[model samples]
Target: NSILGFQGNRDLALNMINWLSSDEDLISIRPKDPADNRITLSRAQMQGLFYTSVILMPLAIVLAGVSVWWRRR
Candidate 1:
C-alpha cells in the first residue's frame, strides 16, 4: 500500500498492527469476507475421500458383521 499510494492500506495495516498490540480503540469484530474463505482439494484427493466413504467403509462394515455372525454360529 505504501508503494502503491493507496489509502486503504494505511487503515488496514494500522488496524492490524493496533489489534496485534491489543489496542482498545480498534476493538470490534475483525473484518472477513466470505468469498475469501476456501477449501482446496485436488481431484485425486477428492476421489480418494469419496471412495473411502462410499465403498471401503461399507465393505468394512459388512465384513465385520459377517465375522460376528460366523462367530455366533
Candidate 2:
C-alpha cells in the first residue's frame, strides 16, 4: 500500500482487521520521517496572505461577477 503513495497508518487498518479475525501476526510498521518543508512567515507577511486570500480575492470575484451582470443586463 505504501507503493501506492499512502504514507500514514497504512498497516493500522490491516492490523485492526487481523485482530478482529483473531490472527496471530500483527504488523507494526514504523512511520517514515516527514520532510521539512514548513513555511515561516513574519507577522506582516501573514497579514498580507490573510488579506489577499480572505478579503481581496473574494472581493475581486464579487466585483467581477457584478460587472458581468451589469454589462449583461
Candidate 3:
C-alpha cells in the first residue's frame, strides 16, 4: 500500500512537471509582470486532466477501501 501510494504520487508529480514544462506561456525567460494573468488550457490537455482524475481517483479510493477492509478482516 505504501509503495503503491508513493508510485501514484510520483506519477502525479511527473505529469504536473511535464505539463508545466511544456506550457510555452508559463516558461517565459523574462518574468511576466504581476498584472499579466493570462492562463490557457488546450482542449486536449483539459480532457486529459478530466479523464486522469476521473479514472485514477476512483481507482485509488477503491484500492484504499479494499486495503482497509482486508486488514480489518
Q: Which candidate is the best by lDDT?
A: 2
Superposed by TM-score, candidate 3 places the C-alpha of residue 24 at a distance from the truth, in angstroms, of 48
Best candidate according to TM-score: 2
- lDDT (tens digit, per residue) of candidate 1 on 1-73: 4453363565567778888998959744455446676779999999999999999999999999999999999
Worst 10 residues of 1 by lDDT: 1-10
Q: How close is candidate 1 to the true structure, as a TM-score?
A: 0.49
- How displaced is residue 41 in candidate 3, in Å? 1.0
**TM-score, model 3 to reference:** 0.41
Per residue, candidate 3 scores C-alpha lDDT tens digits across 16-72 of 666778854443233334776786999999898888899988899999999999999
* Candidate 2 local lDDT, 1-73, one digit each (tens): 5554465455667777778888847756656778999999999999999999999999999999999999999
| lDDT of model 2 at position 28 | 64
lDDT of each: 0.79, 0.81, 0.70
User: Rank by TM-score, descending?
Assistant: 2, 1, 3
RMSD each, Å: 7.4, 7.2, 20.2
